[model samples]
Target: MTDTDSLVADLRFAEPDNPYLRDPGTSFHPVDELDPETAREQAAVLRDAVREHDARYYTDADPLVSDAVYDTLFERLQTLEETFDLDREGSPTRRVGGETLDELDTVAHVTRMLSIQQSVDADEVREFDDRVHREVGDVSYVCEPKFDGLSVEVVYVDGVYTRAATRGDGDEGEDVTEQVRTIRSIPERLAGDPPGFLAVRGEVYVPRPAFREHNRERVERGEEPFANPRNLAAGTLRQLDVSAVADRPLDCYFYDVLGWRATAPATAEPFSEVEDDDSRPDTQRAETAALDRFGLRTVDRSEHVGEIDGALDYRDRLLDDREELDYEIDGVVIKVDDRAAREELGATSRAIRWAFAYKFPARREVTRVTDVVVQVGRTGRLTPVALLDPVDVGGVTVARASLHNPEQIAELGVGVGDRVRVKRAGDVIPQVTEVVDDGDDGHFEFPDTCPVCDSPAERDGPVAFCTGGLSCDAQVARTIQHYASRGGLDIEGLGEERVEQLREAGLLDNLPDLYRLPERRGALAGLGGWGETSADNLIAEVRASREPPLPEFLAGLGIHEVGEATARNLAREFGDFETFRSATVDELVAVDDVGETVARTIREFLDNPDNAAVIDELLGFVDPESVETDDDGDALAGLTFVFTGSLSEPRRVASDLVERHGGSATGSVSGNTDYLVAGENPGQSKRDDADSEDVPVVDEDGFADVLAERGVDWPPAE
Candidate 1:
């Protein structure tokens, strides 16, 4: 028996149900009852587990356990540590996050980046509002979505972008200016000019659509997808290869100008040393508005309310529409609109006193586990999935949830017909949190063999992996499907089922064979599902895909750790397939976003004798295009403008004018926005956001004047 089998053999259970999950009311009782030495030992085990989970969740973007399970381990460790006086430095409880990677230089923040106090209960929020009123009179509040992402401080001097750092340890952070600059939303130069020195703090996150595309590509490549967008964004930022940063679809939403100093040119010393007569925004709303006028993006939706009831109502509304947003937000942040009120309320040693993060309750539901089945992932990891009876979780119907692995299965002691609790983990993935009751049905027995390929699935740590690689029919079908999927080569009429049929017919063995489909056209036409027309169409698509631009070609290969963004960056860097194919590991790693792991994977795949021969053969049949510049090289190439409401022409026409002249047209008002072209009945919220940020708004005629100044014709020559 393997170590995994031995571990499973030792699972302990209570008389009726899984004892592994302790009672919520008294979860730490087992440790509390143990002797001091044993308690310390248990504490150690919990600590290591927490660290491992953190690494998986934060760094690897693949969490081995559910949030509920990790929470239990964390809470238990905290209890044991306090009981035995083991709460010291380096304890998991003391740190905000896992260790910062040494890929970037460390820099001390001008001012500490503090976290706000959080409350899940509405009553607590009310209490906080009451306390704020008692301390500093009745005040209006600015409430916005609390973005789920990495926080960074962006610095500018004399209106020029200079420094960007991560929120590491609050007081100090990693200097990721090189990586941060690659984010399109973050302006390289602040628009409205003229701040002697300023620092704006905001969240950097990957939007949902981009995150979904990234994971889809990962699954196609037979790799584990990231657990959440927040983790993926954070991991991407920390990558050593600056080129790697280019491929990731990242966005920044500025929330606060941490500090700013306005000074004359003659007396231009550091803001910290020479601050004397500069005036700053008097309110949080004003500051965020200033950021918007300065051409920086802010939260898509925010509210300014006069009463506590209004704030609470906004929070409720956000909870209802949370999943609808393009990015993740755990809750809404309510802050005193008046800067004076915030200062008067003061702060605790750790958190701001005037601001509160009204977090939503964890989205959970109760359901019955009908059965347990092993899912063979792209990487061949055998994950046990709880086949749940159809149940509503949050707003969606969940029929299945991940069990993580055998250890989690044993820990839950969940059997078929068992009642279990499930949570919409991060409001995205459904996960089994606990077994509520073990029914008369017996416990689930993990299969010893791979369900897909019938190979011996060997247990290693928490994952049971199938020994089969590309030989597995399921794996091959998935890979080929990935190669033809929308985000890949985008071959029409070739879905997973069709790919499976092709693979089974012995016409397709590897990705390279995809180009040779025309050779098997007669045979394909004679197959059960195919006719001459369909065969010809398939061959046409296969032929058309042979000349995919560099990025699409790289993405189609489904290389490990390489997604759409990474592929795009790589394509741009190498210019041609031959150059990328001949690049060394060091050369690859030196590219912006490519880290050591990704570099090694790329090198190994390309350097392999078999893989190289296949690549060489494919190159003969394909032509890879060079990366083209995103801008049209017009006068306004770097400027971003938003056209609102109705214009003389359609919104698309107006936007096209901007894009044609080398400017970007966006939907929302932000600090980094260069202009807002307003027409009849423009969105009040956009106008309000523009006004707050001091963003300049123009009528159609005024817009024409601005465009004319840029040497663009009012209407292109017809």
Candidate 2:
């Protein structure tokens, strides 16, 4: 078999007969260079590509190509169609999504949920602004985040949540009311005096923290983590079992009020087609405010810009802060603020003319892979990690990236000293997306023995595992570190350095040794850099960690398939350690998110006599506490805010204020930073970074204004 054929076979997927993908490098031939017949043939190829990608993205929730590649194909299709005058009926270009999944019940939308025209260039955004001005002079715009997630229409009657459906197509969608209801942020009942009948359109998303936790768990379990939170959220919502949906940490943020009806005023009109002033929202800002008033989550970052320049500025800021947000957003939705202006501007057959989706530039970066090294995880899984010539991906320096496995290495067709494309999207781990250089032919040798212990290594599916369990020093260190990690048991001050010290002293071997450290206080105190006071404090911290929340304890166990999110889900389902420990494969599989593969993994772990003994020993040293799932209302949760320069108060005071509001304040500016609070003489580098990343910089007063909105005091507590 050819290399591509071998890679395809290794992927365990049946390759589709795609015409456009015959040679991805030659997929697009300039329309101007091609004859009419050739152009038509190319158009046909592009049509197939678009249809295939749409199916992969919408129905399967697993897009085979990157958004950039898909967009390129779509643009080519549009060009060919225009050039050849080959516009076909029911073209994929005119549609919003793929065919509805058979597993989901279909529901026709009350009013069509049309898509927005997308543009990556700033010039296009400027043109859109100029066009709007030409059509309806000097109009204001409400710029909001164009969330990258599954779009859903939520319906309510008599202030009670009634139904919700996914945006499968423009006119119809898949009914996912039961699954959507499980999202805690989405209210079962509307707040205030809501309209008698209301329809709100929103994006169902996985928060960045939840997405990070989920992916981290997947990595620890020797599984390929999800590419992006948006895909995972969509896939979760489409699950056949509602219980599976509930297990996923999902949140919804309403963007548009599609329809509202009030009995007293007798006002009833769909927002999209409202004719009268009374029935229509005066401006986009008013509609968003109404959504917030009715107890729906609206984008707080949304701002009203007077003209095109302000809209562009907002767009830049959003790009800068893209990584800082908990949810994924592809672009800024720039809409004419005035309802009358929007009505006058009108819409196209597929999208609104009054608004445009100004998409952010693709985040992928191409860099040379200097070398490839094998890293052994706590679970004894060997993963090939790529060490790259430092590359800035989406405004972040990514030096090291995951190769996933030997199969992925083969599939990417890359080797050391080769130029490769790396992608950093949201909080997902930096990944080598593709091999760019053709000169390199040699691939990394998949080892037959463990790098650390020289133990026999065996491949299970795509993953290679070392036979040395606790005997492997690398595994032992990683396991100890995992136990002390933030999402695990969270033992204070027990970082890599301390874990290494303990390991070298022969005081640690397994999880139970952590709890027993206090008994050897004198031995710990005698160690270099350790004193009586420090030893006592360490012991106290270790003892305090005995009754960690059940989920954390489960995560600390380093189960093959159990990560923090899965552990939390399992903990929630089973209630306690006893139930989880005694769970059979059937019981485990019955739990939401715990499919047959995971169920078998868990059952096999528990069935092991050695693992059972370790668990029994650990149980005697520690008590598992019930998990407290509810986070106190954190107004600024998922926002990475930075306080720069000098503030009215001390920098610490301002930083503390941010923390109190549930937002993090970093000293440095990066792609992940959402807001930069700049005081007088703010660092030039920070300003430059903000400008480069498109992060918004606000004055000290502006920072205070945001705090006021969150109901937080300007001067935080000492």
Candidate 3:
């Protein structure tokens, strides 16, 4: 029998009969009426039963009991734990998740989590096979889907789940133990007798169906939907509230183990030395089998092959069935079966030599472009968008694709009525790639004037901008909406539709007009679909935002090239609105992440007479507070650090450490940069910049030495 078939057979035979399956309603008993011992015993039984049901549903995908019955059993278990205080750390009841974390802590991985070398060409795959055969000599290969989702490392101790972390930088990752505990597929305790210490790598993902449904619900509620399942899953896993993470339909599939120990260690050390056990799996296939035996969910579709041709066939078959799969996979991963062969091949700083990812071509569809229209954004930038005949690409019906700028349109020579090949870049944004047919049309001419407000449209390099700024109706509505968005002043009642409604009614025109709405409360309330209560609530929210943090105030302005991070940097650098508003380009360039382009953009926006008047008018009602700094030491006050590539800790943690020591941590390498901290697999562009700029490049250890020399601790105190 095949390995998957044998696994299914084993699961079927070992599956326990749930006592609550027949009459779930009859299983309930008041916790108060039961004795302590009775409650504890019943709770244990319920936990085992619930775990079995979960395993059947999640891992095997063959649930014997209905969801209602499972819920009833689970609810009863929770009640028993809450009432009689019979809760255990590994109980299934804890999956409901009420823990709140202030922030995710960093933890070291037992072993390095190296990336796989990937290629889109079949020749590259054959080349990799050649290299493997030259060293390992006719080794078997294991092929599995390369899941496109968040990678994490999960650790277990003595058959109980202990910690889980994001694959931040291979060496260390963000601790997400609380978030991972909520995934029902992951067992709180292993099903069979397992290793004392185990660290496995897996992908956390949202199933496509769940992702679509969630996005649909978000749209119905007038909230912006997530772009894709991978992004949604990553964002959901990072949520500080465990309850919120539990609410999302997140699942995981284990593929590889980083560390394993057969015997229990005396101490609670994460990675303790142990003699190699004969029972340990020696091949990739055997390792997966071991993972399955322990009740960890591994992909059942993976296959073992003796040659590269069989591996290629498996990849082709997976590509054919890609859309039907529950999770998103970008490619097929082929790994040398023998663990000893892998060890012999070894690895580079970034990737393993024994494994290679053969990626599929980007999903593309040919559709006729009906028209090209210019869209004015909140920053008055005009983006040419092509409206196309609706076509399905990667299961998503795409009707429009971005042309980006005039240069893109010219380069592609795309015109109305042209049949163009479109692909979803990063599987999220649709873009026109090539023209399949000219369709008997002349080259489309881009308009020289603003389409929205009939203002002068000026070209800056390849990009076109509407000089009307906030005066343009399209720009006005979007700008005001962004100003009140959650990332901005966070006015609760002012959503996209509401801002459009107010603009259509001529009750609102710009940012300052939103703050002036209380003066015209009667008119606002009398508007169609708006009542007195809604108007009052909106006015109150606007009033409440009269005094905002300096960062929020800067972000609310919707300046070109300025986002939340840059806004925060500006606020930290300038301290107050008056100082920031009057700053020249030279002064603005001193802020972290503010290059000449961004500095000039800031200066031009602040220097505009119309924009200055609007700001002055808004200042009559709004007060922006100075940003406070927590840096108490000037250890590295004059030095500026730019980080690139993977470090021992997350780049954010490293950046925070630098900022805490009164040093500037910028995103890019420039002439002003004092040091470029290059880690494993550093970006080539940053390294080139460091070389050209004559900036010193330091490794992680070198950075630590510099910190020591400055009298600052390497890893900051908790």
Candidate 4:
């Protein structure tokens, strides 16, 4: 049998000690009946069993047990770990993911992650091949499907998973260690002998089937579906809540090694010192094989080709079969097979000389525009949508496409009865690319008034907005949903579906109408899918939010350019709602991080008579507390501090302390920064940035000394 066949055969059977291999009649002890010793032993056994199962399912594609059975075993293990307090550092239970991060930290890559040169023209690809042949005569090439997803650098130390980061700017990336740990396909520990240190570059993506199902569920729940799998994957990896990422169906395929170091048992010589060692992979094909042996999942469709023509044929076949695959691929990557050949070819500053990405033509279809409609978002921005004669583009039947705004509409000259060529931008959002044929109707004229509320529409640069504020029915539904979102008051049971139901029933018309729901509890309980218990719980949650934090209240208003961070800055600067509302444009611009545009937007929102009336009505039911201030002094004023690595306290706490002392703390180092407070094992990227920006680098103790010199106590009294 071939090596691959043998591996597959072995994966079909379970080890004798595996919990699932036990006799069907044999009953397991319940959690309540197990002693500490028994629970500990079972936990270890379960961890091993689950790891083996994950290998079979994710890597080998041969699962011995059904998903239901696997879930049962996983839940039992989690229960044991939590009940016995036997959780270890690398427990499989970590996959469930409950950890939350204040922000994504910045880290330096062990080596630069370069991009591949790409072109949609076949001639460009042939030129690349000619150059490669000139440098390294007659070298074979390895071809792989170029995944349309986010690129990440995953690192391992001593055969155990260490950390992961995004491929931001090639040299620096945002740390996503906890988020990446939740992907089951990525093994926490290497299967065989691994190098002392390894950093592999890979793409993380969501399967197309899962993406469709996720979008379907979102639409059913009255939530906006994500544009495409790539956007979803990127957003998921950057999420601060690990649990949210864990709930999503994310997978990864490792492609290239960015860094490697040999250790004892593998080799005594380090990777940098070993030039011709057989222990290290000599070719791209062998490197993929080595990654597979180390329990890393590599692309299955990769192949070795003798010449560029064969690579082109492979790309053609992949493009034809793209729709059949579970993941999205926009092009095919061709790389020099031999490592020596690649070194001889060398590389440019931005991309490698021995590799090229031949892209496919974008999927597009020509269809007629039947009508045009306007959509008003929660923030009052107006969007123009084109109703199209249904056409199939990239396997999706798109009946509507976004015209974006009036400027785009005028540029395309698109109107009713016009033939337009539609393309799914990024293989997700359908948009009109150009007018194929002008119709009898010359061009579509945008409305001068809001279609839903008849409010005067005004243009802000390229985009337009409704002056209706909360009066528009379309805007009110979305506004209420945003008001109760996690970034807002965080009231439970105020999801999109619930808000729609309340609106359709004429029970809610404005922001203050939500607080008035308590008086209409009897009517709410009578609605479909809601009983007395659910209604009362929702009412209680609403009542509980009558008095919210100033920042949250500000953010919940759906004000333009006012997100969580900006709201916090505004709250800290003004202290109270009355002061913040009355602040002038100049005063708002004086706040940290608030630019002229954002300051003007905030002022415009508060100065509007309609918005003021809503605020006055809301104030009757809601009382936002004044933000606490440091009355002692602003000794650290006019200074900006950036932090990296593990400090004496959490980074957010340190940042809050800085803000409390009238100083600004940012996430990245720049020329505006005054000091970089680097704790133990601080990121090398921040240090490099500090050097480049000529900013001072100080340890935690030095920071404390600086604070002490300002008459502020370090490690503030508990």
119 Cα displacement, candidate 3 (Å) = 0.2
Taking all chains together, each candidate's TM-score versus the true structure is 0.43, 0.43, 0.55, 0.54
Model 1 CA lDDT for position 80: 81
Worst 10 residues of 4 by lDDT: 268-277
- Tell how far residue 84 is off in model 3, in angstroms: 0.8
CA shift at 356, candidate 3, in angstroms? 0.6
**Model 3 Cα lDDT, one tens digit per residue, 1-718:** 9854654455521333445433445446667789989988877777777887788899989775788777778888888888887757998878878988999998877788889899989999999999998987989999999998999999888889988999889888899999999999999999777888788999999987677667545432223456567888999999999988999999999999888878766766545243345667899988898899899999988999999999999999998887568887889999999999999999999999999999987644987776677777666887787765456788887867889999999999999879899999999999999998896677677788777667667688999987665556667777888888866788998887888788767788777898889999999999988889999999999899999888788988888778766887788788899989888889999887899988977886776666677789889989998865556588989999999888988665676577767888887888999999999999999999999999999999999999999998766666
lDDT of 2 by residue, 647-672 (tens): 87856556544554567666578999
In terms of TM-score, how similar is model 4 to the real structure? Answer: 0.54
Q: Show where candidate 1 strays beyond 4 Å.
A: 1-102, 264-277, 365-718
lDDT of each: 0.73, 0.73, 0.82, 0.82
Which residue pairs clash in candidate 2? Answer: 208-326, 316-694, 320-693, 320-695
Q: What root-mean-square deviation over C-alphas does model 4 reach?
A: 20.8
lDDT of 4 by residue, 1-718 (tens): 9854554445422345464632222256788998899999888877777776787788878776788778877888888888999866666678878989999998877677788899999999999999888877989999999998999998877777878999898878899999999999998877667777777899999987787666545432234666567888999999998999999999999999776667522443222232233456789998898898888999899999999999999999998887668787889999999988887887789888889999987645987776666767666777888766556898897867889999999988989879899999999999999998988876899899877677778789999988776556667877888889976889999998899899877788888899889999999999999999999999999999999888889989888678766887888889999999999999999987799988877877787677788889999999998876544468788889998888888565566577787888886899999999999999999999999999999999998998898877767776
Per-model C-alpha RMSD = 32.0, 31.5, 21.2, 20.8
Worst 10 residues of 2 by lDDT: 268-277
